[model samples]
Target: MSSNKVYVVGVGMTKFEKPGARDWDYPDMAREAGTKALEDAGLDYREIQQAYVGYVYGESTAGQRAVYELGMTGLPVVNVNNNCSTGSTALYLATQAIRGGLAECTLALGFEKMQPGSLGSTYDDREQPMMKHLLALAELQEFAMPPAPYMFGAAGKEHQERYGTTNEQFAKVGVKNHRHSVNNPYAQFQDVYTLEEVLASRQVYGPLTKLQCSPTSDGSGAVILASEAFVDQHGLGDQAVEIVGQSMVTDMQSTFDDKSAQSLVGKEMTRKAARDVYEQAGIGPDDIDVIELHDCFSANELLTYEALGLCGEGEAGKLIDNDDTTYGGRWVVNPSGGLISKGHPLGATGLAQCSELTWQLRGTADARQVESAAGSNGVALQHNIGLGGAVVVTAYKKP
Candidate 1:
């Protein structure tokens, strides 16, 4: 099928809150976000030809129920679940529809109403989806902690043993993201902390403090995608953010073959996905001015620097030391605070990243905006990953 240009004409998100902190349910979250997005684009619900809704914890037909709150027009509502990458998976599908000439306008919406505390297996009667990853990790290291932190922390420890990455370096990520969250009104935790404060926060695993981990959140985010023709017809040219490139990759043979902790948690998958997106966009990492990467854990952020080609392997620590990833640096990353501080409502995470990047490119991110976001050569990059595992990398720029 021939491809057509796709643009994000509008984006919106609920202020991420702790699970059970808000009285509203998933449908309400979807409505607020979806309505804002439609309004932002000056489009009516009837204009949307298709919709995709993503959530990890939900009943069957939940997508239909959620979209019904927006409009009962019976448009196709595809439910998506790809672990934490669910949101971007939905966005990826919507992009395909427009690119393939199936739909001119589509909505990608995601939300999660999570249970408080560390994530765990939901069904003991059935085999866990992460069994393969868990088994692979067991071969490389002992499992003494919860699965999530232990896996990522083991990767951090590996980076240390191989490259002398210190706990201080990993802690710096927590500092940078939390500090960035202060300027974002939508972040769940806005209070900043010193390096010592972050390090001293209760340790969940080796070099990982509670501060570095993404909290289970309850929120929703929505984005409206349109074909280039639709954008022109709707007079959305000024606000449209073009999706120059996007790629989603799952686990590879190296994930199990390399027996490396980072590889186990999707290092190579991210690398290949980022490579594909750069090739598709016809731009490299150097052209990016802002980023909204998945920082489910601070360690993953450091490892992703190498995976996304932002830095060489084992040199992520030096990147942090040079302050190259924050304001007044080489790139302003996680300007919306990322999952670390903004909260990780699994399904909502990727759409939140999309929303943040869209706002950045439009020069409307206000206090959380990057100074170089409007640079002629600048583009925004987004990375979202899940441990089962899947990763989506996307590049965006103002039209």
Candidate 2:
């Protein structure tokens, strides 16, 4: 099947923040980000043919509420929830709509409000008590299913033994992200921490310090996608960021139920997604200049290096140690501080990653720009993984 072409015309995001003393709801953030996106695109809300809103824990008709707040005109709105990948998945849907000629222009919005007190068990199943019991047990065990030769802390221990991926090394990720967060006006955590400070912090998931985990945050991000024809018609051909490739994959849920650290399911799914994207775009990993991987945990980022084929298996530590993934390195990863430093508002994360890539491809990522090598067309990749190993990858190129 021939791939349909699409373009990203505008992207916007609100400053990620922990819900503070003031009363700011998810719709508030959504309107702010969505308005900013429309303004950035030099278009009005009326120009949008459709809207896709992604949220995980928001109330029913949350998208409608936001759209109403933004002066709704009865445009069709579809709400989507796909765990952490909600935002990126929404973007994918919008792209497909435009590519399939279903719509000339679409708005993709992702927003979330941090639910008070422990996120309130969205995974609970009232229909199947037995399944719910198993899920509860898994949660109590920190999502580890035993007797499968893989436990929750097994990977950490193995990493420690093999590559000396210490708790401190893991802590370093938090410290680095916080340091970068200090410069991000939109980041939730502005306070920077030292490596020693992170090491001294409280532990969350054993070897993974509190600082290493992303906090529940309130934020929103939006992107405007248009068909190639629409972009040309609007005289925005030069301003559009080409969607070179995109892919999505889902693994057997039973694989995660098995809880094997050696279960390459997540990695394998991401690899297949990347392969599909590369084939569609006629490019390879070597052509990508920047990347934003789902970094809900520091270890996840390490695993992504291999998943994206950036390095061989077990070489992620070396890549990080050599600073190969930093700004001036061969491939820059997570210059937006990632979820670790920027904060993860579940639904908003994936779109935020795409927004970061849009900036990088447009040469507008001030202070975190990666200088593309000679004859190298700047390319950026966004990777998002949802619950139970659902993966999506999107590739973009500077026009």
- Best-fitting candidate, scored by lDDT: 1
Model 2 has how many clashing residue pairs?
0
Best by TM-score: 1
lDDT tens digits by residue: candidate 2, 201-240? 7655556666777777889999999987788888877667
Clashing pairs for model 2 are none
Q: lDDT, candidate 2, residue 310? A: 91
Candidate 2 stretches with Cα past 4 Å from truth are 123-164, 253-259, 262-265, 373-376
Cα TM-score per model: 0.99, 0.89
List model 1 lDDT by residue over 86-150, tens digit each. Answer: 99999999999999999999999999989999988778998899888988888888886589999
Q: When superposed on Cα atoms, how far off is each prediction in RMSD?
A: 0.9, 3.7
**Pairs of residues clashing in candidate 1:** none
